[model samples]
Target: MLAIRLLAEPERLDTLALPVRPARGEESRPEPVSVTTALPAGVVEEVAALVPATRLTGAPGETYAHLRPGRTPGRLLLVGTGDGDEAAWRRAGAALARAARDETYITFALPDDASPAAVRGLVEGLLLASYRFRLTDAGPTPSLTDVDLVVADPATHADAVEAARTTGRMTALARDLTNMPSSVKNPQWFAEQVRAAAADLPDLTLRVREPADLAAEGFGGILAVGAGSVNGPRLVELDWHPAGATTHVVLVGKGITFDTGGISIKPVPAMKLMRKDMAGAAAVVGATLGAAALRLPVRVTTLAPLAENMVSGSAFRPGDVVRHYGGVTSETTNSDAEGRLVLADALAYAVRELKPDLLVDLATLTGANAVALGKRHGALYSENDGLAADVLAAVDAAGEAAWRMPLPADYVEYLGSDLADLHSSPDRGAGSVTAALYLREFTGDLRDRWLHIDMSAPSWADGDDAELTGGATGWGVRSLLRWLATLR
Candidate 1:
């Protein structure tokens, strides 16, 4: 964990000739200073004159300039954000986070007269941008250390600090789970990891419904998708029911450890990054752990359908009809469309077994969503207007972008099948909506209280960078956490 220390006085920033003043027990600190629209004009001009142009431009993303503070063990870094707009400031913050080290300290100097809202926004953006998955520390540790926030006195800013801490922890957990490769985080490993991570939390209970249990219970969707792997599938449940809870929020994630598109088999190049198919599962477990740590009053139940949809002799094939947990049958039109199948059983289990008041399912479900919304955002489909509004607000608050997607009632026709109760994949057009329709069949009992989040893009980045690490972004956890808190 990165240590965050707060300093109040405005003079503290200049006294150290760095963004954040040094404190006792901290040997070396990064001189990296991120400026926003909140930055004073004089400060921006002065820093701009000192740093090189190339560093100035690149500083918006990943470049840094070194500054000498005479006796201070570390160097000062001036980060430029072009016009200093809010988005620019956010990018500048992400750039600093992407450049930070575990050993070096960072201080974000607030503007002299910045509003409380701006300060809060800056801290949230910085924490979200700085997230990384530092699991075993198998590689070199970071030299960029602590995060310092120069603000008003703690007495006046206690709420801001608490909010920052909460968001930071949420981001860290999401990053940790998303960063793992599919090889090390398959269905069984995913369950074991969740158990180990939350073992000491008395408020949390982690349980894995293994292959035997799933088979006996007739969870054909999960078993069919995971049969290709030697590791097998599992339904991981993490429950947190605080005393005197007012709301019951249920989260279902599609945890496909590695997807080879099943027997429908994706092209080799198209299937290379299939490991990230389980990002939705990663988000749920990560959020559950954070919520337990936060000790929220609302009762939270997380259900993850863990599987590896690979191609093998035993793999479920196109035209195969699977009997899900709800007693509904699905004709596999495209084995690549396996996420909804696994989720069908899990969602059914959530409503039938846990009986939560509301349901939200997250999955990297369709390529159509990426084509529809692009990267940096996910598609949110909800049956109820109130839930959609609440969810959109939470996603906005978390700064993890999401757009509300329509689940067209007319597209229900595409999923109709003659041989089975439903078709897993309909026609290619409106593919994302059609996929949601298939999942809705299993969720008919609770249509008004369900949300489907398609997180296909942010789970894997196309480029190599520190903040993203070219792996999972753990996209949905913070949004889910914020949403759950609001429910209470």
Candidate 2:
């Protein structure tokens, strides 16, 4: 684990990193902004002479590194923070982390006018952007260990800094859960991991329901999906109820530990990445842990339906009609569309038993969402306009992206079925929209206050971008945590 320390005042340092922003009013060319630096006048002049040739205009995610010559070698990095926004700061922090990868300890100079939120964003970006997860038998490898950020007033930004550290830790945990191999991460394994992570947090309580418990509870959707797997299925519930909390929010995540598409099966190329099918569950767990760590004044009940959609003799067929909790049935037209089936059971349970004031569900429910919105944004579907706006606001503040998709009433017809009350997948177009609609059926009368986030694409990052590594991105933790802070 990397240690992120906040410095009250500028400390004497041989290695100094300074933020370089774009030219402001009445300026045409880029220049290194004044910061807390210990560089001598001669060295500063040397850097001035080389700035033009380097073409470092302070673009976000850009860095220029130069070694100062002397009896002792010193390092200098000109990091970019475009427009000084939260997103820009995130990019700048990532670039700085990469630039300083070789050093054991380095100091970053924060602009005097930087706000607490910007400082928090910078810490999160550096922590997550430098993230690398690998399964190895070798003992812990040494790498960049300590980051000391010099801010104008550490006292003013103390809370933000600590919050950023917590956010980064939880997000990394999520990425680790999603990046684990399916061979090791069966439904039972997922439940045990959750248990271990929540052991220290006494305010957070976890309950794991095994296959028999699920069967007695009438979770046909979950049981049918996991019937083919030897590992069976689990419903992991975590509750965080703090003192003086009014609003109750229930979060449901689709935990398809490995999606081979059940009986239908997936193509060879697609099944390779099925390990990330449980990203939604990972994200919810991250958010719940974050809430508990931060001690936010809100009641939260998180439900994760864990299962492995594999192929076997007992696998549910495509034509099967499965009954969920509360007796709602889905005509399983496509075995590949198993996320919604499991989510239906969890959502129905949340509404019937939890009686939450707000319902939010996250799932990698459809590839069509990825096809439509690409990997940069999450597809958000909700009938509650207020909830949509709040989530979008949090997305902006947290530097994540999500586009609001509609829940067209006319599309409800797409979920209609002859054998059951609803069908899992649409016959033709609007796969993502219909998937959201199908999940909405399980929400019962709480449809108006529900939010269905189809995070199919954004859950996995293709490459190392600003504030994210190459594998599981842990995309929802930051945004969801920020949104939860606004409740009540």
Candidate 3:
């Protein structure tokens, strides 16, 4: 994590990043944008004097970083804040981070009129872009150690700055867990990590269900999926209950630590990417912790069904019919679709026991969602129009990408199973739609308030872009945090 400091007035600033806007009209060579700020009277004029030499166009993610030794400001970085919007600030922050990757320390003066949201977004981009998860014993680490955000009124924007820092730290936790090697990231390891993290959070309780407890409680779906692996399954429950909290939100995440596809094995190429099958689990855990840290006024309980779908003689087969926690039987159609099986048991349990006012589940449940919404956005599914609208609003406010997918009643026909109450995976054309419909079955009478997020593609980024790093993107945490904030 990068050291983030909100400075009211620093005595020294070796390197400075100045925000620039685009020129009025197009030209072969556009001049540097006019500097504007409430900075010291002489400082603005100093930067303005060098604008002609900078020769920088204010494009998002564009930067001119150079260090002039013995100069008052040792290094000057001109960052483009396109349109002076939240997104542009994020891009500018990211560009600055990459450009100054080798620098030890840097100071950036916030725009004179930058809102709290823009400040938060800028820090989020810089922190997330600087994130690096490496396992090797010997390698170069990111040289940029600390960052200073020079603000005019630090007291006014202090809360927003902390919120951004908290979000960045929590998102890093998700990324680290999701990027873990499959060989060691089994059910037990997942449970232990969740427990350790919860210990640091006050008033947040954690309960772990071992294999025996799971068996006694009739978690047939979770057990069936884990039967083949040497590591047995586990269920983690993280609870954040504030005094007099009226609203209850239950979150379920599919924690398939590693997916080998069992009897219905995927191609070698697809199987190689299975380490992040548990991205959903990491996401929910991250969100719950964020809620607890922020001391949000809503009660939150998250259930993570941890399992490893491996190939062995004891593995569940395509025709196997397994009863879930709440007696809903599912006939497994594709062992590769094991996420929904464990999720079914978790969701059923949440509805039967927790009885939350609003229920949401996050999972990398299907590839079809990527085909529909692309990698940038998660596919959201909900039966109730109002709930869907609320979630989409939060996603927009949080600066996360997501699209609302339809839950057409007609798609329920694809999940009919002669041997069981539902089909785990329908081979129908609309795999993502059918998958959402299958999850709706476990929500019981509270189905209208349930939100299903298929974040399969968005959870892992192909490369660094915007606020996302190269590997695990920690997709759902920000959106979940924003939605939780909206409650009450």
Candidate 4:
């Protein structure tokens, strides 16, 4: 974890300077000493003069470096913040952290016009970029141990700073869980981790249901998916409720520990990254714990169905029909589409037993979502306009990208089956939408209160240089946390 602190005095430490350029058509050189009150007396002027000939355009994620070589050894990193908006500040912060990875201590000089929200975004980006996951290897650790955010008024921004820290910590935790190897993180292992993480939170209550319990309780969908694997399935239910909370929000996650596509078996290249299939469960656990850590007034519940889709003689296969918790039968058209099968039982149980006011389920369900929205955004689908609007607002505020896709009534026809009530369509087109519609069958009357997030695109990154590093990005945690904060 990155150690973060709030500094009242900027002159105390050697810092990385973020200097915003004047807008186009402005005066070439403003007063050096009083350009803006954001920085210490002459910091901006010093940087501007050091690199005079080169243009100091304040584009987000842009950097310029200056080093003094005499008796007074010092380094100044100039970062750009175009428009100085929250989004720009976030990118700038990430760029600054990545650039200064060799430094032991660094401080960010906040701009004069920076809002509390902007400060939050900056802190989030800094901590996220500073993350390094090394469990057993004796590799070189991150040089950055301490960070200070130099603000104009620490007293006024205290709450926002704390919120940002909490959110960053939770997101990092989710990423760590998702990045773990399947050999070490199977169904029972994941349940134990959740139990231990929440054991100390006084406001949270946890329950773990093993295969026997699931069998008796009629969670057929989950049981069917895990039948072939040696590691049995488990359902983890976590609840956080404050004393006077009235609204209830339930989150369900699909935890396919390692998807071999079951009997249908994926290609070798696709199977390599299937360890991250449990990312949705990671986000659910992270968000629920975050709500409890913040002690939000709203009640929250998380149901994670953990399993591994492996190939064996007993494995579920094409043409197999399984009945869910509420007796909604589904024919398996493609065993590669096993995520929705596991989620079906969890959603049915949440609506039937938990009876939440709002239901949001996240899964890396379809590759079509990635094809439709690309790798930058998750696909969000829901029939409820008001709920969708609130979720979209939360996504914007949290700086997590998500695009709303239509759940047209006509899409339900694709799920029709000759043998069972429903089946997963192998249609390459709109695969994401069809999967969401298939899960809708088990949602019962809570369909209007339901929102499904297809997170295949944003859950895992493909490269190290991107804003989100390669591995689990913890994509949904921040937005879900912000949305939970909005509950009355």
Best TM-score among the predictions, by candidate number: 2
Candidate 2 off by > 4 Å = 10-12, 36-44, 71-73, 137-142
Give TM per candidate: 0.84, 0.96, 0.95, 0.94
- What is the per-residue lDDT of model 3 for residues 1-488, given as tens digits with 9 covering 90 to 100? 88888877654578877877777666634334443335444556666655557766677778877666876677788787777677777778778888879889888877657788888888888988898988995887779988988777888788888888888888999999999998778999989998888889899999999999999999999999999999999999999999988999998998999999999999999988899999999999999999999999999999999999999988999999999997889998789889999999999999999999999999999989889988888999997898889889888876678888888888788899999988888887888888889989989988988999999999999888877889999888888998999896
Candidate 3 or 4, higher lDDT? 3
Residue 169 Cα positional deviation in candidate 3, in Å, after optimal superposition:
0.6
* Model 2 score (lDDT): 0.87
Using TM-score, rank the candidates from best to worst: 2, 3, 4, 1
Taken over the whole model, the C-alpha lDDT of each candidate is 0.73, 0.87, 0.87, 0.83
Give a tens-digit lDDT track for model 2, residues 207-275.
Answer: 999999999999999999999989899999999999999999999999999999888889999999999
Steric collisions counted per model: 9, 0, 0, 0
The candidate 4 region of ten consecutive residues with least summed lDDT is 29-38
The whole-model C-alpha lDDT of candidate 3 against the native structure comes to: 0.87
Superposed Cα deviation of residue 389, candidate 2 (Å): 0.6
Candidate 4 local distance difference test against the native: 0.83
Which sections of candidate 4 miss by over 4 Å? 22-44, 70-73, 136-139, 426-428, 465-467
Per-residue lDDT over 32-129 for candidate 1, one digit per residue giving the tens place of the 0 to 100 score: 34422244345555555554443333323444545545433244454444333444445555666655544356666654444444445445556665
